[model samples]
Target: MKILLIEDEKDLAKSIQDYLKTNDFVCEWVTDFSLALEKIALYDYDCILLDLMLPRGNGFDILSHLKKLNKSDGVIIISAKQNLETRLEGFNLGADDYLVKPFHLSELLVRIQALIRRKKFDGNNIITFNEIQIDLLSKVVKVHGISIDVTKKEIDLLLFLIGNNKKVLSKEAIAEHLSGDMADMIDNHDFVYAHIKNIKKKLKNAESKSYIKTVYGLGYKWEDE
Candidate 1:
């Protein structure tokens, strides 16, 4: 999943980024409110970790901006402000969850998963479409009750495709989702094609239908046949 972390503490932000990365989350981080505002305005994220104390502006303003744009990105207030007023203000501004600072990274990870599940999957950890079953927590894929040997990236791709269903996803979008902050450094989207090819081959071997369809001159879509 894609996560935007708006934090001012450089060390804390890096630690959070590194911890989330190890759990297969694409995290883009900004240390100031200006950059955070720019990112939230320009792109979409599965979840945002917002700190109330920021350099240029308060994180509550970011929440107001998201509300103004009608963006539904799940937000968790990771702030040092533990007062009732601040918490209430955050919730009133549409924050999904709250996490006080000096918190455990593992707890934060689970919170993000819970928020995403509630937002995207109706609080279900298992995603099933036809004969395929994906366990979000275990990162496992099964077809016809048989397990498939797929890499983490393959599972991520599968979820990305299935989550969007019939929508055509551009290579750039997939690349950004996969690479996070390093996406700009990627000169070519060849890795996306490679990952898709690998996922298709593995699914085919498991006797699954060809759900991933390539749109010529465009991108790809996961269609249910």
Candidate 2:
């Protein structure tokens, strides 16, 4: 999954980023409100980690902008400041969860996982589509009760496709989701084709139904046959 972490503390942000990476999550971080504003305005994230205190501006301003845009990105407020009023304000401004500073990285991971599960799979860690079953917590994919050897990147690609269901996903979108903002610098998204091909092969080997469809001149979509 991809997360946008809007935090100002350099050490803490790096620690969070490094921790998230070890768990197979892509976390893009911004230290100031201006960049946070731009990221929320332009891109979509599985979840957002917002620090209430920032340089030049506060998290509330960024939260307000997100609310105005009506983005579905799940948000968790992380701040040293704690109170009922602040908590209520964060919720009123579209925050999904809150975590105080001096928190455990493991606890933060659990929170992010729960939030993403709620947002994507309606609070279920297991994603089932026909014979395919993906256990998010264990990072396992099974077909007909048989385990498949799916890589982490392949798992990410599979989730992205299944989460969108029937929506057409452009190669650019796939690349950006898998590679973050760095995708914008690349002239080709052909690597996305490779990921798709691998998933297709694995699913076929496991005797799963074909769900991913190429849209010819457009992109790809997960459609029921």
Candidate 3:
């Protein structure tokens, strides 16, 4: 999933970014509230980690801006404020979860996972489509009791398609979802086609019906009907 972490603390931001990257998540971080606002305006993030206190602007302002945009971006507030008022205010502004500083990174991760689960999958760890079952928490894919051996990107691709089933996903959109802003710098999105091909090959090999279709001159869609 794509995560935008807006924390002004340099050390903490770097640590969190490094840790999340190691855990198979694409994370973009900004230390300034202005930068955070720009990112939120320009991109669609699966989740946002927001710290209430920022140098130029407060995180609450960012929250209000997000609401104005009608963005369903899952937000987790991480701040030093442990008071009830702050927590309540964050929740009032539509924060999915709140975590205080000086907490374990593990705990923060757990909360973030829970928030993502709630926002994206309705708190389900397993995602199902037809005969295919994906254990999101474990990162496993199964087809008719047979486990599939797939790479991380393969699983990401499958989940993205399944989540947006029946919707056409542009090559640029797919690349952005998988590779974040770096997608724009690439010379080609042919890699997306390669991933699609691999996914189709694996599913077809397992006697599964192909659900992905190409929209010539446009993009691809995950349509089963």
> Residue 24, candidate 2: how far off, in angstroms?
0.4
Q: Which pairs of residues collide in candidate 3?
A: none
Clashes of 3: 0
Identify the runs in model 2 with alpha carbons over 4 angstroms from their true place: none
Evaluate residue 20 in candidate 1 and report its C-alpha lDDT on the 0 to 100 scale.
95
TM-score, cand. 3 vs. native: 0.95
Candidate 1 structure quality by residue, lDDT tens digits, 58-96: 999999999999998999999888999999999999999
Residue pairs with backbone atoms closer than 3 Å in model 2 (clashes): none
Candidate 2 clashes: the total is 0
Model 1 alpha-carbon miss at residue 205, Å: 1.1
lDDT of 2 at 119: 89
Score candidate 3 by lDDT: 0.88
When summed lDDT is taken over every stretch of 10 residues in candidate 2, the lowest stretch is 62-71
* Better model by lDDT: candidate 2 vs candidate 3: 2
